[model samples]
Target: MIEATGLTKRYGKTLAVDNLTFQVEAGRVTGFLGPNGAGKSTTMRMILGLDNPTAGQVLIKGKRYRELKDPLRTVGALLDAKWVHPNRSARAHLRWMAAANRIPAHRVDEVLDTVGLTSVAGKRAGAFSLGMSQRLGIAGALLGDPEVLLFDEPVNGLDPEGILWIRKFMHRLADEGRTVFVSSHLLSEMALTASDLVVIGKGRLISQSSTKEFVSRATENAVKVRSPQLEQLRTLLVQAGADVTDSDDGVTVSGMDSEKIGELAAANRIALHELSPQAGSLEQAFMQITGDSVEYHTGLEAEAQHVLEPTR
Candidate 1:
């Protein structure tokens, strides 16, 4: 379990992370999501005590990470997969990490097999693929058998198979009552992997809720109505106070459901073509939230502001 309070980080005049506060509970995987430059990495580094926060503190199991007696046994983190030496074999790399933390060397072999890198453990990391490197990093993290695990973009460069493996692995770990916190750019993947989500934007907390609640709240309820008598259907829907947009694709109706729309169309005696409900996806929800904070906006006023501003 982990808790962060008022976590803030600054780089010169720029505030990279701003007053972020959140909790990672035990026995579930909590996803950290944000656009690029949204301070996710800074927050993770602060949690791991790799980077001191400007004005806040992070605790692991009710104590500061740095103060933990056996940090490796308490927290296992894979900040970056490229951390390993390119020339060293995977086994050697994990062995060195284990040595530094006073972990048993046998953990190296056990984790190697756990990550499915046993056969290729002797191969040079330089010759390994991106997925292989990610697996090796995960193997190293699991070496300590820590209760809390943190993975930053664990599937960044992984192939489809590797990505699926990582998703299931995280769920499995959480199901076993371990705490798992993972950050990802891929909203779709997170939708499948995480049960709970913590979303941030512009270095601020946007949401923290169960995955089902998040998706449901983020999605707009929309209904699609199609009819040969398009004009009659549109008129009926408009009269009923539904936002109707007619297009070649079909008539899109908002603020009403398919069954209601069907009743309206039937009452109007409009010959039906098709009617269905549309659900917004996780990617759609992410885009909607981040779209509000997009650094660049295209419009006449924005262009004028750009033109009037002095160039650096």
Candidate 2:
């Protein structure tokens, strides 16, 4: 397990990470989510001991990363796929890391095959495509067969097939009882893969909760009702203490379930054209929750593409 208690970081006058505290338990994929400039990269660097924290601490298995006796076998991370030396062959790169850490040479080939880079392992890393480079980076991280893995934007440049493969791979790793901590801005992908979520903004923790709970809280339970007398139906719903809003062809009622709303319309003798529960998508919930936390504003740019809605 990985734990951070009151973890903080600062660069000169700017605080990159505030007093953040969280735990990544084993046997699950915990997604680290935030907009750009949220200090996720800084936090990952601090966890690996590559960047020192200004205050507080990060622990790997209850000890600092620098204090670990066998760090390679305990924690594996893919922070940056572009960090590979351009002149080095994939095999030679892994060989150097293994030799420095006393890992057997045979393990290099094993990881190479595991990431499907064995076929082109002889090629210089600079010639590899972005997706291939990403795979190579993952191969390097798995070289030690560590129980804890950290992936930062692992699918940044991957194609659809590559993205799907990684989604399954991350879940498979978690199924093996490993701690899988990944950081990404891909809300839809996170919804599909993560069991828990850690949302941050401006280096501060916005939420630390199970995926189900986070989505549940961010989304509203609403019912969509269509009727010839849409305005009358809206009034009836409002009078019944429901938060009503006008939709394109119907009215949306919150604070009431679909069945309950149907029953209400029936009792009121309102002729209904359609009635259905409105389930909010994960992307909607994410945008709602992180709306204020976005570091960069693009409201003007998006305005041209925005569709107009009837205000109620």
Candidate 3:
């Protein structure tokens, strides 16, 4: 298991990470999520001892990364797929890493095959495409078969097939009782892949929960109802203390669940054509939770106003 308590980092005047406290349990894939410049990369770096924390601590299996006899054998990471020698072949790159960690030479071939880079094993790292480079990075991470893995934006350059492969590969690692923590901006993919989530924003922990619980808690449940007497139903629903919104096909009712809405319609002698509960998507929940925490805002009006304003 991986744990961070009061973990913090600073760069001169900028505070990159706040007092983050969370645990990544074994045998599960935990997604680390945040908006741009949310300090996710910094936190991951601190976890791997790539950057010293300004305060607090992070540990893998109750030991600091620096204290490990063989750090790669205890914890594996792919923070940047391009952080390898450009002139080296994929196999050569893994070989170099294995040598540094004292990993067996046979493990290089095994990991290359595991990542499906056997065909391109001899290809130079510089010539490899983004997807191929990501595969090679993953191959390096797997060289030690470590019990803890950290992947930062592993799906950034992947196509559909590559994304699917990485998803299943993460699951397989977790199934083998490893702690898998992945950081990515792909919310939809994370929804399908991660069993739990660690959400941070502006360098502070916003939420830490299972995927299902987080979504359900962040989203407001609503019911979609359609009837011939749409106007009447709408009035009745509004009068019933439910907030309703008109849609193209139906009126979405909130403040109550589907069963309550159905009972109300029946009592009012209304004929219901369609009645369905709309569960919010992960993207929706993420937007709702991180709406204020977003650092970047884009607006044509804001830009135009800035340009038109008088200059001092």
Report clash pairs, candidate 3: none
Query: How does each model score on TM-score?
Result: 0.87, 0.88, 0.91
Residue 237 in candidate 2, Cα distance off native in Å: 3.0
Q: Which stretches of candidate 2 lie over 4 Å from their true place?
A: 225-235, 243-251, 265-276, 301-312
Q: Tens-digit lDDT track for model 3 on 1-312?
A: 999999999999999999999999999999999989999999999999999999999999999999998889989999888988999999999998999999999999999999999999998899988888899989888899899999999998899999999999999999999999999999999999999999999999999999999888987778889999889989988888998988889899888898888898899999999999898778877876876677876796346434433234
lDDT score at residue 226, model 1, on the 0-100 scale: 73
lDDT of 2 by residue, 172-207 (tens): 999999999999888889999999998888999988
The TM-score of predicted model 2 comes to: 0.88
Per TM-score, what order, best first?
Answer: 3, 2, 1
Q: Write the per-residue lDDT of candidate 1 for residues 159-215, one digit (tens) a residue.
A: 898889898999999999999999998888999998998988888889899887887
Better of 1 and 2 by TM-score: 2
C-alpha lDDT of all candidate models, in order: 0.86, 0.88, 0.91
lDDT-superior candidate, 1 or 2:
2
After the best TM-score superposition of candidate 1, give how far the Cα of residue 73 lies from its true spot, in angstroms: 1.6
Highest-scoring model, lDDT: 3
